[model samples]
Target: MSKIGQAISEIQTLENISREDRWVNRLHPLGKLVLTVFYITVTVSFPKYELAGLAGMLLYPLAVFTVADLSFGDALRRLRVVLPLVMIMGILNPFFDREILLTIGRVPISGGVISMLTLMVKAVLTVLAGYLLIATTPMDEICRAMRVIHIPKIFVIVVLLIYRYVTVFLSEARRITQAYELRAPKQRGVHYKVWGSLLGQMLLRSMDRANDIYESMQLRGFDGNFRLGKKAALRPADFLWPVLWALVILALRLFPVVELIGRIFV
Candidate 1:
């Protein structure tokens, strides 16, 4: 498939996953959002040399995947493009921080190496937590959770519209590409000479479509304020999920859980 088509499919797949009738998907969005934020904050708060403590943070995403029956391999695959960039953020750390902090036998490990690994772990855990949240929670529910937290209405509306219309924008681009391909058969890709004209046409088409969408919204009584249906009352599970996870996360953070476990066996 073309790259654009693959992009569209990925978005649809995420939407489908969120809509699945799984227990995790059914949990209240606000609780998931809270836990995700808390998990990320704790993960990033660890000391640069405290790799063992940060290692314990992996439990959160692992539990979610197991409970939700999500494919860990698939998640990693979908995130392949992003993981490299995140990993590279700390590549220079090893060069800048060369203090010897510890040794295994005769071999010495520098502070730079530990900190670099620590940073990479932090990046992976936080990114996975975010992906899990989005994979399980629909965009509407996410925005609703934002509203519950008192996020500005304008910001919420902008987020919702951008997500909702992105597919439309991509679809238009795909149509233009296909038409161009038909006219210029045997070309490997779009010619540089036509790039500007193609983009101009896409912009014009997208603007017209946006105006029509806005008019439709007006006819349907879309005021400046976006409205969601009456909020659902919070359930017991909604309260329990975040509380339970928070305690586990805090215990891991405050104690040397990984090191203690290693002592039991060694």
Candidate 2:
């Protein structure tokens, strides 16, 4: 399949995963959303050179992946895009921070090298935390969770619209690509010279598609408020998971859990 087709398929697969009868999907969206936010915050709060503590933070994603029964291979494949961006973000850290942090046997390890590794680990774990939420919770459920917590009505609606539009725009672009490929069968992907015109045309097509989608929504009486399927009650028991995980996360963040564990082993 073409790259564009593969991209569309990946998106659909993610949507399917969210709707699957997985363990994580079985939980209350609010619980998952809240804990996800807390987890990311804790992960990001670590100091750049605190690599050991940051390494221990991998427990969150590992726990999520194990509970959710998500595929590790698929997770790594998805990381390809993020890996480049993360490297670019931290590539210069080594040069900027040349402080001799410590000596490993003979060679000195600088603060920049340590911090760069820390930043990259933080980036991977944070991204994984987010996708774990998406893997288990549908976009609508997330939006509903936000509303339940008293987010502004207009903002909720806007979020839903943007999420819906992504699929619509992707569909429009895919169709355009197919037509271009049919006309220029010899070319591999869109030519560089045509990128500007192709994107401009895509913009026009997207706007028209958006208008059609809006009209359809209006015809279906889609008021600013979304009406989702009758969600099961978010029970008191539902709060247990997030609360427990959050406590563990907080403790790890405030205290040196990694060092304590290492001391015990040593």
Candidate 3:
């Protein structure tokens, strides 16, 4: 398939989680947010050269992925965009870090290179954790979680609107590309000359759609904001998941026994 077709297909796949997946989806969104932040914090707390420590961090997300019944391949695919950028940053480290920090034969390693690798792993794990959370939890729940966590009403409203409209923007972009392909006698790379007008037309159409959306909202009595009424009460499982994962992360990072096995295997 063409590049645009591939992109759209991926988007549709990511949007496919349904209410039946509620075991993972039913977790309070705030709980998921807290867990995501906690996981990131623990992963980033280690020294930059601690490859074993960083690799050990993968267990948490892997276990969660299994429990959630989420697709590992799909999550990795979504995360590919960030991974290449991390790899590129890691590749650049050797130039600036000329000091030979370690060696395993004739080959030398630098502090910056080690640090970069650690950073890359940290970034990848954190991003994967985020993707996993979003994959299992709906966007509306996430926004509602933000509200429950005492985020400002304005910020919550803005986030909700953006989440609601992002699909619209993407759909419009795909339509524009399809139209371009249809009218042009031959397919061509996006030319500089047509870009401005093409982009302007997309923006114009987006604004028109936004205006109609605003009108509809007003008719529904939206006065700059809407409230998500509290539905799912916090359950015993909600508290248990975060607390349990927090201890697992702490054990992996702090206990020498866990670290030793992690070093030996990972």
Candidate 4:
């Protein structure tokens, strides 16, 4: 399959996973959303050189993966493109700060090296936290949670439409590429000279398709707001879920759990 085809398949797979019957998928979306936001906030709040403290933050993802029956390897593979981009954000940090922060045996680790590693960890943790939320919660539920929190209706609508129609956009692109390949069967890829014209054609076709969709939505009474059925009543577990995770996250942030564990063995 082509790359665009693979991307569409991956997206459909994720949507299927979100709709699966599982305990994690059944959790109130608001609680999971709040916990995800809190997790990312705490993960990024750690001191740049405090890598050991950051180690404890791994627990949240680990617990979620176990309970949700998700594969860390699969998550990593799905996020392959994004992870490298995130990790690269810290690539130049090692050259900027060279002061030695500590020594292990005969080797001295510099502040820049520690900070770079810390940044990479933060990147991975934040990305995985987001992936966990999306993997377990359907987009409609997530949008409902956003509306519950009083997010702007327009913003919510845009997000919902974008998520729903991105596949349409990709499908259009795939068709365009396939047509080009058929016409230029001997060519390996689209010629640079035709890139602009192909993109223009794709954009026009997408806009026409979008307008028809919008008209259909209006006929169906879209009314500028999503009616994602009745909101589920918040259960006791919903209340307890975020509170429990918040306490654990706060504890990890406030204490050097990794260092203390090492000291115990020492």
Instruction: State residue 5's C-alpha deviation in candidate 2, in Å.
Output: 1.8
Highest-scoring model, TM-score: 4
Worst 10 residues of 3 by lDDT: 11-20
Candidate order by decreasing TM-score? 4, 1, 2, 3
Q: How do the residues 228-252 of candidate 1 rate in per-residue lDDT, one tens digit apiece?
A: 7777778899999899999999999
TM-score-wise, the better of 3 and 4 is 4
TM-score of 1: 0.90
List where candidate 4 sits over 4 angstroms from the true fold: 185-189
> What shift in Å separates residue 67 of candidate 3 from its native position after superposition?
1.5
What are the RMSDs of all candidates, in order? 2.1, 2.7, 3.0, 2.0
Predict model 3's lDDT versus the native.
0.79
Cα error, residue 171 of model 4, in Å, equals 1.3
Task: For residue 243, give model 3's deviation from the true position in Å.
Answer: 1.6
Per-prediction backbone clash count: 0, 0, 0, 0
**Candidate 1's C-alpha lDDT?**
0.89
lDDT score at residue 80, model 1, on the 0-100 scale = 73
Report the C-alpha displacement of residue 213, candidate 1, in angstroms.
Answer: 1.2
Which pairs of residues clash in candidate 4, taking residues 3 or more apart in a chain or in different chains? none
